[model samples]
Target: MPHTYLVFVWHMHQPFYKDLATGEYQLPWTRMHALKDYYGMVEMLEEFPSIRQTFNLVPSMMVQIEEYAKGEALDPFLHRALKPAEELTDSEQEFILKYFFQANPSRMVYRYSRYGELYDAWRAAEGNVERLRRSLGAPGMRDLQVLSQLAWFDEIFQENDPEVRQLNEKGRDFTLEDQALMGRKQLEIIGHVLPAYRRMALKGQVELSVTPYYHPILPLLCDSNIALQSHPGVPLPRRFQYPGDARLQVHKALDYAEEKLGFRPQGMWPSEGSVSDEVLALAYDEGVRWMATDNGVLGATLSSLAGVRETYRPYVWKQDGREMRMIFRDHFLSDLIGFVYSRMDARAAAHHFLDRIRENARVLHNEGRDAMVPVILDGENAWEHFDHNGRPFLKELYRLISEDPGLSAVTVSEALERIPATELPRIHPGSWINANYDIWIGAEEDNQAWEYLLDARQTYDRVVNGPEGAALSEAGKAMALEELLIAEGSDWCWWYGPQHHSENRPEFDKLFRDHLAHVYRALELSPPEHLSRTILRIATPAYQQPPSGLISPRIDGEISSYFEWMGSGIYSPDHRQGAMHGRDNAVREVRYGSDGQKLFLRVDLEQQKPGALAGLEVRVIVKSVRHESELHATLLENGAKGTVVRSTRKRTLGAEVSCAYSQIFEMSVDLLSMGGRSAEMIQLQMSLWRDGLPLEAAPAQGWLELVPSEPSDWE
Candidate 1:
């Protein structure tokens, strides 16, 4: 029977924990989980040897994994996870023994009885861990190794970690030794598993794909102003040309993939499924035969494809008189596995997915048309949440597709190979994000943040394009350009959501500033004060303390509710002790006083290990109840003095510092001064920073009430 459906998914992503400066990896759990999830998925492909899938191994992530596979930086992090086993009590020993007895494939008959004796000796000592340790000391390294291997099975998926997430932000550095270790791991993975992927693609078992370098929101990188149009409250940074920069990003992806992967990818998954006509034209000019975006983009850009009103079908997109095949992803189906399905049983989820494809195929056949359903999502993230480490679901899904007569699977490249390019219409400029740039640029908090970014961008542009521009060597110029490009990614700005406006805002500011600073330094500019002045002008006030007593977190009154995982450590409330890699966590206390117009907020952040102190930042934002006329103050400070007190900065203007004791930092605000009389609500954020940058920060908010000011209320 002719194939009625084509299942194509391309997993694209970079580990946010990979530190750019020293190239060190902070989150070992992400790597450990990703390895199991991805490897398990690949192994499942064995059941349906003929089943095809596309895997886009980001160059950066590929590098990090290779380093771990070769005993580089990650070996130590792995060592740390294994260290806890040394202190296990009697009950813990029993737990380990029972768990691994069912796990290890190479258990010696005598070793089983040996483990039982150790278990018995430890249990006989009750809860005395020293005795247990002494008893296990004989087995020592061997036992620890077993425990280390077993830790991988703990089944807790690592999500956004605040510590690791902060490292991804600007101005943070990983030590050199750490970087070397991570680099070695990347090279190792390249030598080891990457080859398996290459061989699979070469053998037609899978297809390989690639994304733009640094995985930026291409449209925003082209023109920061796109945000101003969509987000009314958000201000545009210095104006940037669109089509020109877009071209650079597209060409860069093609060149990198062709050079590293041995063949030009037939199709590209624009970073984050971000797309527009300008983006598509750039892709086609650079030889991208096809690309895919979220179905929502197609629904907006073209009302219908191939006479089909819906965007779920694969169709050709025309841009600038050139045409390329485009596939609109069924985000609901794809993300079901990435985010939602993790809560379900692997078998049930797999069955449900297979059934959907079957139903789609049957319907298409009944209607007399071919059904090309694009199932696209992140490869590593989805499996981390799945049961059996996503093994059963993946295997079942691939097997059902490969063996079932009703459906067939093909890699994106294979499908694109079957279609020929034709002339296309003029494409528009936009992204899958909010149908415009509002998510990145629209918001009072976002606009204020960009005002500072614009100042910094202009400062850097002047230095680079000035007389110093002529004297720089070719390499220096190239480095400056690349640094600016990397710094311009849109992820930092879009992190503003709900009341969390200042969360990732500072990092956005610092990166834009740092790149500009690099340009000034390279050009022999003097007195860093010029840059500092610009930063402070746009800097918001810091909070007096971190949030405390976070026995439970509620969002919109729902216990432990989490909506977005942009920058704050991917704190999945269900997992205790696991940090959100590349995200931060702060607990907050909100109390309203005197008819509701007066507000008090306390933010508390638990410290990381000693000597990791960078500093803390606090921003208090007051908005009119109607969500208009916003005013804010930002304060930055170093050290953790657990007390609520105010201080002034002699060297800086408008600097009023407040701090609190007991791990709970408080900031008090009266709405009357900042349009509070006419406004109905208020928002405050306190973010922790390392080296003058913001980490995971959540907003605390409340409605305003009319009240008389106490005699104590004056600046």
Candidate 2:
């Protein structure tokens, strides 16, 4: 009677966006996600009493939610959303055009007909304020105001709330009353986020967990050098060792949860599923009975790959008289839900997910042992990409899980009760990414941010020990320390590194520095000059290097040898720009080169799997002075069969291509086919398409250019 226990931990969090000095929230995500995700995620569970899950709520997010619920949050976005359309200044109109349509274009914006119309109008105008201002009158602005807010309302709210439903029916030419009603409804939804979780936890339908206050990486707080353990030779900032701060973050989270939620949380999903031996000790000391991190960490700790059997069980890590149970998230399953399933039909995705779980479970069952599959990921951000905000998918998944006798969806705590723990003698020190701290440390920008934080911490310590600090009020000292803790948050470093990029890069840069500057202001000290400037460098576009020399390699779809393409022109896409949470970039880097007779191109993927590239089409478009031509390649069957490479133009290259799973994808085309003879300059553009959707494009902003080599030089 072996059964599979399914653990779904939805980590809900938003960075602390409030400026303590100004009392104004800098970002509207906390409010936006509150309206769309938090309450509804829990409320939807009521439909299926048999299914149970866990929700990890970060205290900082809850604090902001409370502010919005009480109408104390002075968020500029809210102010703009609530403003009368006719009274909006030109700048305000411009701001609306820039940010109001920030929701998912396909799922959220297009869901509302009027909002889609406004988005199309603004897009058609090429985001020009003057053109949009002339084309879209007050009526357009009013409709945008109502529909922008209305688009974020949870599917449940849209279905149940009369005002929201009426607004949906009205579609366009929304009145001032409609706008005012949307604003009120937003606050009303925000109010439900916390209480709904409390009610769910109380009902035992969901288990509630908490992350560290301000969501700092506890291991790094304990010591920045800990990063070197996972990533040896990584350039680090000045040694930042502050176990006390780490302890405080954990302690505060537990205390806040007990006070706010009317119950003590027994489990902690440390910020970003970041953990170490030291972090475990801290959590265990704080009475955290269980914790979770990605399976990559578990694999690294065991010095072997974590397969299904290794990852599908609970384990105990006991060191130095402190212990806590741990679960490693099924990275593949979780990512499929977060990234892949959004592109799939709801029922099909749900069935595929459940079938995978069942198939995986059947293996363990055959061995006469039960299995535990932990599926954990960010709960809020993925839904925007999903139709109906993923409600249909979740309902289908939950319904399937509830009906299956062999499968049981349980909270982490519930799973622990039924499952026996295996001993993990030691644990790896890393976050969920690659089981390494590279995302938060090692990078030049990440190191610089740590150095800045170290200086601020040193200043605080010196002032507090000196007579000037002793004479300062207790409130001032506390504020200074709070700012230091906020600066310790992992979010600042997430954006600082080269690993990730987003549209709001400058804002994050400013916010991180602002928190550090506030630390000095709280201590009555002048902030450093560096604090006033940005830490972020203007990122170079995707085309980093041009073709250096001729490269003629076998079109075997693999990096056959080190020297095969050494001098190839490389184009690495800057994925940080327009970065969406949980979305994986399929195209890692692209290289192009040419021998006198043929053109060679290669694509490296972030992941190397033939299945991942299956159904994906890659196109290399070349424009020369005289003609334009394209080479199309469709990846299939781990590159074994069904992959076809074709050329569209009068000249054909006899194109050949290959796909190497977990390696490179390469192709070769005849130079004469590309008009290389008549062309003096050649421009290249590479695009990856899946199901007709452009997944990624190289040279994101422009085309890669190469001046054709002189015939004498080619000789």
Which candidate ranks first by lDDT, i.e. highest? 2
lDDT of 2 by residue, 1-715 (tens): 9999999999999999998987988778999999999999999999999999999999999999999999999898889888999998876777777778888999988888888888899889874678898788888988887788888899998999888899889889888888898999999999988999999999999999999999999999999999988989989889999999999999999999999999899999998889999899888988999999999999999999999989999999988888799999999999999999999999999999998988987888899999999999999999999999999999999999888888899999999989899998789999899988888888888998999999999999999999898788899899999999999999988998778978777668778887887888788875654464457766445648898877778777666798988778888877534332223668788888777656667888766454556667676776776656665667765662223244455654443333343256777655565544623667777776553334556755457776545463221
Across 621-674, the per-residue lDDT of candidate 1 in tens digits comes to 333443322112232232233322221212221222223333334444443334
Off by over 4 Å in 2: 539-715
TM-score for each of the candidates: 0.59, 0.76
| TM-score, cand. 1 | 0.59
True-structure RMSD for candidate 2? 18.6
lDDT of the candidates, in the order given: 0.49, 0.84
Return the top candidate by TM-score.
Answer: 2
Off by over 4 Å in 1: 15-20, 26-30, 67-191, 227-238, 242-244, 304-309, 417-430, 444-457, 470-478, 499-715
True-vs-predicted CA distance for residue 552, candidate 1, Å = 46
